[model samples]
Target: MLATPVVFIFGRRFFISAFRQLRHGKAGMDTLVALSTGVAYFYSVAVMLLPTFWAKKGLPGHLYFESAAVVIAFILLGKLLEMRAKGRTAADIKKLMGAQPATATVLVNDQPQIIAVRDIQVGDQLLVKPGEAIAVDGAILSGRPLINESMVTGEAIPSQKESGDSVYAGTINENTAFTMRADKVGRNTVMASIIRLVREAQGSKAPIEQLVDKIAARFVAGVLCIALLTFFIWWAFGGPAELSRGIIAVVTVLVIACPCALGLATPAALMVGIGRGATMGILIKDAAHLQKLAGVTDIVLDKTGTLTLGKPVVQEGLWLDDDRDINAGYPKSAARLLAAIERSSQHPLAEAITSYAISVYGKDYSKNNDIDFDHNANAASYINSVFLPGLGVEATLGNDVYYVGNARLMAEKNIVVNAGSEKDVSPEKPVDFLTPMRHDLTAITSFLQAHTTHTIVYFAQKSAKDNRGTLLSVMALADILKPDALLTLQRLGHQGIGLHMLTGDNEAAAALVASQTGINRYLAGQLPADKLAYIKTLQTQGKSVAMIGDGINDSAALAQADISIAMSKGSHVAMDVAGMTIVGDQLSKIADGILLSRLTGKTIRENLFWAFFYNLIGIPIAAGILYPFTGFMLNPMIAGAAMALSSICVLAASLRLRYRKLK
Candidate 1:
């Protein structure tokens, strides 16, 4: 009688939840637990209270108060262990949240004022001291600092930041203090986005989980039906102690069949896998994408900002009348003209040329004091300046028109590139300076075009008399490859994954990157639509393609691919469309993400197999199927222990994913 109050107080949750589920016309695992324990408790109570009534019917009148209490105790212990293990699965997310500082030093009226991180608003100037974590995402306004981004990017090296460079929240300032204007605050920060993505991914269910749900929904009801059948079969056929044997068989069947293991199989694995990924700087958006990553057969990569560093620099430049001498006066003059035209454009190549010109030639290259050749002054001299997308820029400089762009842009302007020949040159102009340098210019252009794989830009001058342009100089620009790009591609290639490159750059530039990275198939000069169409074509051939890109042009292809991966350093548009975001802009994380998915998938399968196999083999023995053959019957206490062990086994299998190395 003392144990009855303890059982009701501690075990009332199961009975109440089971009742709520039955009212909604559904039966779950709680229903089975409630019915089994309730039967044992009430039956034991009846026997203890009416000993004379039971003796009259010839029943043993055994009190099962200890059995009821023991079963509930084992189940509660199992639930407590499972909850603790589940909490560990989200440890990475908690670490990320902890990385965020609680307070920020904001600049109020040009004075440092410490305020709550939540109270920070956009455009607030915040001061970060050395060793302090960044409060929010923003651009540096004054100081240069070495920021440790390992918390966000998983890179051990601290990144050097300068004015106009972007800084994300959760990164620590390793060196001197810096003041920055906040652009993204609170939930809009990158750290918040990563945390949100990880939480959503862990909570979301995979496709295989849907099937498991359907099975678990009816599992309790089926177990109840089997338990009823076991009781009837055992009671009708037993030659001695029929009632006692029937009650034991029914309790064993109900206790041994566990639905909790089946329900936890997939989610447990997914939670640990995604949390592991987050720690490694691979943010998976959902469980479906995480599962899909394991089956990717092909990976498409973008050249700029993906395989390469995306920072284009001027590699070499050749002036028409200068004999391979960049320091010559004419070469400097030509570079100045190129900078004057390119400084107004925002293209990466254009910026490279402008910076090269300023660095090679002093900020003020012109020697004559009479001519004002400053950037702002030179920019104002050109009239009718227009930027042509996918080509270059055209501007009217005095009486002559100058074109600074790719070869295609030169072709559109009717500029004839005379290699070693002066066919399009005006007859009236001086040919004395061009005669000796014509062969040198041709050799230089040919060498640059044939030997070097750098992106070439043509600078030409359109004559007012002939209405045709003459090529003046050729500039070669190159985007450096990432340190791990080659090794990452090699690893993926060894795994039998087909590698393909798609870029809007020229064929020469594309060929260089492809050769360096060992990519056999590549398509150059591809626009955003072309990239999208290519992904579709590959999908039609029954290939699962993962598109990895880091630009606005790649947004369409990223959205269209089977799986989209974006670099953290890339544009927000690309990351927004990507299924996975690789922090630190590391190419090797792609392989890590895929490997983690495969391991997680394997773990989920193993867990599901164990859950199903345990119930399939345990329920039968509990139902007394082996009684006629082996003369063995499963005990109710042993069945309860087995049920608790099944859930623990499933959780242990899933937790193994946390320790397994992704590589």
Candidate 2:
């Protein structure tokens, strides 16, 4: 129970915030106020009886009434502020529900109508106007336009989308009109999921939270026992004059050690850590991941997709032979011819080779395609490039124009080569290595075994009929590591965090990427399920693993990991699965996240120590440690002041997090 005078002093703020909260349907706040007032009044009437008891026992009225009022007032006021702060933050569930849009324009019989967001159901059609927010997750049945998904996905740039493109709520349609088929409404959308996860994470108190309760419960019980003992020793066993002093001692100990500070220890630290992590582009997701991440020792990398640029580029090409059938096998001359045709195209592989041409030959050789490749009617265009859907473009130097694309492009051009044939030059083997890759190639080894080219040479050819044939010889096409990637990997290693790679490409490519990224150990040839299985295997063996990914394919692994981190530039599915998302592509943020979590952990321990030790040791001293000889009895006010001091210590420690300056 709180003291009476303190209730009268600040009764206004409590009743106001409480009443306002109650009007908004926050019963907890109302109930808490009622409980506080009820408990306060009960204690008030008890303390009022104190002066009567003293008078009846032949003591002065002035000493008994005045001291009781002052001591109780101070402790109660401190508790009031703490309760207010807790109520504000503990509205986690409300915050989660707040992320949804309150209303949406629904399509009724093809006419737009407004309705409460909650009333909209799945399968409802919603008309999305230009320059407005998408109110729900839906697919566009019509119109093609670009979108800005920055608020939801952190992708600031506008990306174009056509009919059949899925748009998420909270994503702004930059310059297009889309009629949406609502797949998810209100709190069930992706944005709603993020809000829900954040809420759950926040409400989830750490072990420290329960520990504080344990300490407070135990300390409160023990203090009451000792106060009872103190009353018995002085009043029942001593002279009549001792009863007044015993009454003062018993109340003093109870008032001085309320356990307010102990209850706050874990929460104070948790708030600091959570706040710090949010600013650093890392969300710890839960107390368990926050604490466990600080101690991770091994990082496994998914090779092809994680480290080196997942995109493939033309490395080297050479003219091996003209009669050699440029399409028949891999040749230095064919590599260069493929490089030139790619220069004519604007596709990724085309740009890769075009860039290669500029780098090696100092000329941007892109061909202005007069027509977009549509179907077999553009079979002439098919002769020049092969499209690897998830990967990049590959070029085939053929009897026709230079072909660029996946293995399919080479086959479409009718350019088949026997892998057994050998060629001259730098790397693998077989001029026939230039053949179309088999669709059945599931593993990286299977793909490499099919390629027989040694030195990839780059060259430009005039046309298929040219006596010199389509062959441009120069340096090989390749991908290089970003200069900072290696340093990030190495530094993360120093912090005892493992770096792993993930990719959907071949193993040789995977190894090359891993080598560049400085990851010493790697696993390749994994489909999404394979990666998930690996995560489960490691977890079963008792490993604390964190999976970092930025694609839909990584969703399963992200879900199964002890900690899931998504790239801010990643797909929506990946972001949904991860515990935290980096606002930028930098992986160094992971290391920084762990540092902040550990700092919060330290603060929690410190606050608990002070809260625990204050009650553990202070109550005995406050009960008149030297009462017999020196007669140094502790007053109720001093005990109340000590209780306040413990709370202040916790608050001061937590405040330091605001200035922690994590780089």
TM per model? 0.57, 0.57
Q: List the candidate 2 regions with Cα displacement exceeding 4 Å.
A: 1-41, 45-220, 227-235, 238-251, 278-281, 285-287, 300-402, 406-408, 411-469, 473-483, 495-506, 516-521, 527-533, 657-663
Q: Which candidate should be chosen as best, given lDDT against the real structure?
A: 1
The CA lDDT of each predicted structure is: 0.74, 0.56
Residue ranges of candidate 1 with Cα displaced over 4 Å: 1-206, 210-225, 238-248, 319-348, 355-439, 451-455, 458-473, 478-480, 502-516, 523-542, 551-562, 571-577, 624-641
RMSD list, candidates in order: 13.3, 11.2
Instruction: Estimate, for each residue in 1-663, the C-alpha lDDT of model 2 and write its tens digit.
Output: 433455555454555655775687643322333333433344446556676776677644332232333334433544543343232223433433444467778889988899887788899988777677788888888876566654343222244566788888766765546688989876677666655444443344534336544654455456657878988888776767788777767766665565556656666666667667777777544555565566565555443223434344655443334345646554433333444456555443455655654454443334434322222223324455543332234444334444343343333433333222323321233223233333212322343344333112223333444322222233344444544567768778888776666554446755766655667666665655566677777778777788877655565566667676777665655665566676666667777877776787777788878877887677777677677779688766566567667777888888798788664
lDDT of 1 by residue, 1-663 (tens): 666765688878878988999999888767877887887777777777898977876656666666667656655654553343322224545655777999999999999999999999999999999889999999999887777664444333355678989998988887578899999998888778656654543453444547654765678778888989988888789855576677777877876774557656777777778788999999876565677789999999988788988777777766663233545455555566666667666444666888877665557443323224333345435546676545667877677788888766876776654422545455454333223334655665575666467667778777576555667777787787899999999999998899999986768778888888889899987755677789889999999989998765566677677788999997665676576889999999999999999999899889989988999999999999998899787777677678767877988898998899766
lDDT of 2: 0.56
The 10-residue segment with the lowest total lDDT in model 1: 367-376
- Tell me, by TM-score, which candidate is best: 1
Q: Candidate 2, 244: how far from true, in Å?
A: 5.9
